[model samples]
Target: MKHLLALIFCVYFSGCLMGQQQAEWGNWKNWGDQEDGTYLNPIIPSDYSDIDCIQVGEDYYAISSTFQFSPGMTLLHSKDLVNWEICSNIIDDLTQISESLNWTRMDRYGRGVWAGTLRHHNGRFYLFFGTPDEGYFMTSAAHPEGPWKPLTPLLAEAGWDDCTAMWDDNGKAYFVGTHFADGYKTYLFKMAEDGKSIDRKSAVLIHSGSGREASKLIKVNGWYYLIFSEHKPGVGRYVMAKRSRKLAGSYKEERQLALPSCEAMEPNQGGIIPGKDNNWYFLTHHGTGDWSGRIVSLLPVTWVDGWPIPGEVLPQNIGAMKWSGKMPFKYTEKLSIKRSDDFDDERLAPQWQWNYQPRKEYFSLTERPGWLRLKAYRPLEADKLLKAGNTLTQRTFRKQDNDVVIKIDISNMKDGQKNGLCHFSSQHSAIGIVKEESACYLEYRKNDNITRGIPIRSQYVWLRTQWGLDSKSHYYYSLDGDNFLSFGEPYQLVWGNYRGDRIGIYCFSDKREDGFVDVDYCHYK
Candidate 1:
């Protein structure tokens, strides 16, 4: 009897331990901090593309292209290079820059706010970015998280992108960018000290190739390194470098710096910055698009004979891609980019952004105190998810399987209003409450196809989307918020408009605009 009791106790103890371990680590899909002094590749497994990072004091600040998403150019802050969080968004109203970015137009799908450079000099932070149609624009702030000055047009000509600026030792500013319309030709020009304008008359053609772009200029050890990406015939986009003793002209022949691996597609289009320990590191995004978009990775850097080589150095001075390495700094706290919102705060979390410049009158956090109230509005294009205005969204993580559950109150929903959760790229899938006449029904929409389920009489319903590594999503709806029934067909997530899949909460009406839904909370994992 004693032996049997001891066996049972041991079994119970082990089961509890296993359950605790699963609860701690099982749900997370994209945790990079190993917690053992090492970190993994794709430090951020979301769609933060066209990245540029800089070290300001002990804190590291990085920025990424937002494309058509409003709050253009996301800015991130990190204590250690492996752990990052959204600090702020540079452009709050993208319509201020171009009317094409307005929700009514929604035309700048893959073109607005492309690759940019972030630099801190003279006690201020400066950001320079360009659009394919709007040429180049810049903004500056006293701090990384800031009241940024209104964007000043640096150049108003089209066909230019991927702009970087550097202030030399003598305080002379220089700008480098690529002109895609002109055979991918790269040029260097003198920039004004204020960084508000560029001296186009000082333009000098530096490099030209079949598909050369993503220009970054930096000075290290008295050599000005011009780093960019060029398309290889069959190998995809790869990082290349050209060094010159002077800022202009006569650069050495380009050398291959980093190449794509089977796991990381095309390690290109990012900046190299010195770590806190004075060692250099390269933060880049995989150029090739996937369901997760261009995910970010941090590569170890080695200075070989005055050249900064990224990843493992191979023969002929090329860097082979790596998957894991020692942590740049010994940061023990596990940080995440995922958000769980309770809707109690006065402001939305930094991770949230509208599909475009939202019509602020239709969204309210104060309307219901502890809930997010989204009033329905007629979309510019009727019955189109992509054309809906005021849809709040955030990037979906793709490292492993993940899920999101949102509780919404549909009591206030009016006829012809659709209120629910959705995940979309170019195409979209949604599971939500669709009201018709005087009854509410649960509807699952995949692109244009609609599947209506039984009538829902509840005031509140919980909607969930579970997505796996296969890039497929399954949706569920629950009345009690405990037991959930599958609602939609297996929807495949996709990469489009140069963006990864984004999960959003939408409330819109195809008819009148008097309906509304209150989102109680959103739990994402």
Candidate 2:
């Protein structure tokens, strides 16, 4: 097994070295390709973890776990698996699931909608996810980019996570999920024809092991294959599979399909999708991550004696694998997540996500014609950005370096209101304009410590934050859009709650709820 893995890695990387050079590395938007058909690992440079992918005809849709960001699930679309774009979202508001998300006293953090499965079944798209605290929930849409229906709680019981749904050959439907409450056992339960509810009495213990979850049932060549990931002592977490002629019990032997590479220690938890040519490929995430969070990668899967071994299994380089491969399909065009916003559109871009279920009445794009108008509303309880409701944000892309700038018109601001641009996560830093009873001042906030009274003479200010690959963040402000000046100290951007940091635009008041700010534009480069 190890030799086969090494051979595969050497063959692919050898091909990659022939055309790609070192100087071309570190560009996030163009990370995957040599521009000559070969591609690299971590096709995506940012944290797009816990992905579930499905191929519908010529198009592919992948959804990722978004912990507390409103519009719970991130939907991505791709023509060739190497390039992807943020296309749509699964849920509009998470308050539909639990009011605890909206409670300023409590923040879900890294505990909201988690690892989910996306499947195209019977003319509709079904997406299912489970929260460790809130049990299982499912939502469907006739179209992937959709006006999706409200969420339906499949089971009110907690402790179940990483679920997948399947329909067998006999027209019988089954739901497979893992129970964390009972020593991490994978269970299979019968489901109604409509796939809305599970029959608990028909549940059977199919697999039991440590760190075993993300169970997916696939039928190929007259066999029911149970694919899952498990963690065993020194081996770390690896993908495994078991097969049977029947759905109930008495499944066959298990096979270790794939292991971590030296560069990617935990390349676990993703889906298998076949290409247009009928070749199989595995889309998984590199688990050991920096402050930028887990990044997703695509690996080729070859069947040896009916077992799918993804990429190479290199024992000598236990933490390394082939970093590039020939494109599974012909290249169409390069694509990536959207970062810049002109605020000229009638609807918010798919890239924008609220910190939580936003107070719908506090923001508007049409109010100022070409600007995003955010009304300042006092927090229900907490004063921090993590718990502050209705802050619009998006993930910070992990690369060599990046800059974010936003122009805010604070002429509409009232006394005691603060509006600013922030880099937010469990720990956050912000540079913004704060209005006091007598005057306005520029403030820098980090670690709950404030350095205020840096007097700025204008109501219109451009706030900027630049984050580097080293995880250092620098702040600046400009009265004129071009002449920017540095401020305070350099802040360290960090990650928490199973999420990377986010660039956020926020508006809120300490005394009243009627202040407002008009953001003319936000640019990312």
Candidate 3:
């Protein structure tokens, strides 16, 4: 009640945007220099950032950052944290997050899965996430790899992100997450017993004291432990643990949690579960600079008299932990990758899908012919509202910083046939090209200097985009197959009504007669 009144007072006095009342994503931070990948940049797979995990039986189920892509929750089941694969998305049923493909901060385009909570209790598995821009949502299933239920948006205090769940022994349930709508101030709260809502009656803890507060609650040895993160990126000060006899107060904080010794410190939103061996461990996602290609990192947790301690930090290495593909006789194991999609395949790889309602007739392909044909007839804007879709992108947040280059050839094009590459956040500012009557036109200038549609002479042109952190992105069109030309401005990707980052391919037709872009093949190099 007081918080609500305070929020109302702040809104009236601050002239801030109507929201959770905190400062968020737009904060200026320069993180483009971590390009060398030489120094221990622990955040390698920046694709799935801000992770929450749980151990179910012998398997470990984890979820992470989704700046709003379809199938919002990327669910992975692993035997060993080393080798991971997509089992199912916890949000397969929610058309809003899926069809809307709501992203993070419009600047964080095409990113959908963020700080998801995955757990299994009494034969049922539940997955929860903070659509920071849209409150909280969750789903459940009989198994980790399952036909997850539709996304259920829960009651969340305004101005919050990274909401996670917990169950206390006294038959009480709780959810925790923080928001910074007010400049940089962060606050924490508890969820209701039903788990579908944030308990307004519960006490609130404004995070003004010791640690980075994307916190997790765990009960061990009859005492409750609060394991948390301090916001430093790759360098240490990342993880910490606190405990209290009661749920709301009487808590003590640990001085230092992890000691990786890097230049960053963004150990955020975490989860813990007892393995089959009864050994407890910490599961977290490490931030790769300011770029949100979040990666999954595991730490075996140690506890002392109910207080949780993060385990030893592993040396940083990229895809270096090569465990056997599928091992037996284990506490946690990895599943085979279900992400390999061959455009030649008749159907879209179960894992690869469009953001919203896909006009299936617009696409065609033959396994024997080895090419995917998309007739470009509809104007890209008509198919996509003031939002973004009509493009093929992937959940690349936890995958880390790497240039993705797509190569495809067009057999022919009509004056209305517009097809090219897209790095989208919203409809306002996006970059791509349209081949009209054999001449290539870029979607630029109108989008301001952010993304300009430049026209160049050529029957065949190679369109490329270099998307990176610090909003560092560039578009290039090469008329001469050998060299490339940089377009007018470098797009600093920004999210729209919501927050997200998207990298994909788009084709549209505004004419009554439909036409399309027949992509011979595409390669991510």
What C-alpha lDDT does candidate 3 achieve relative to the native structure? 0.51
User: What's the lDDT for all of these models?
Assistant: 0.84, 0.78, 0.51
Q: Rank the candidates by lDDT, best first.
A: 1, 2, 3
Give the per-residue lDDT digits (tens) of candidate 3, residues 201-287: 564663543335566666666667666665432233345566666665456544344443232223444677665455665556554
lDDT over C-alpha atoms for residue 162 of model 1: 92
- Report the lDDT tens digits of candidate 2 across residue range 156-271: 88888889887777778888889978888888888876678888888888777668886766767777777787765544566778888876545666776765343354677788
- For candidate 2, list the clashing residue pairs, or say none: 5-313, 261-319, 261-320, 262-319, 262-320, 263-319
* C-alpha-based local distance difference test score of model 2: 0.78
lDDT at residue 276 of model 1 (Cα atoms): 74
- For every model shown, the clashing-pair count is 0, 6, 96
Which numbered prediction scores highest in lDDT against the true structure? Answer: 1
Q: Ten-residue segment with the worst summed lDDT in candidate 3?
A: 317-326
TM-score of candidate 1 to 2 decimals: 0.93
Local lDDT at 215 for model 1: 88
lDDT of 1 by residue, 299-403 (tens): 988988777888877664657566688888875565567578898988888889888888888999998999999999998888888888889999988757688
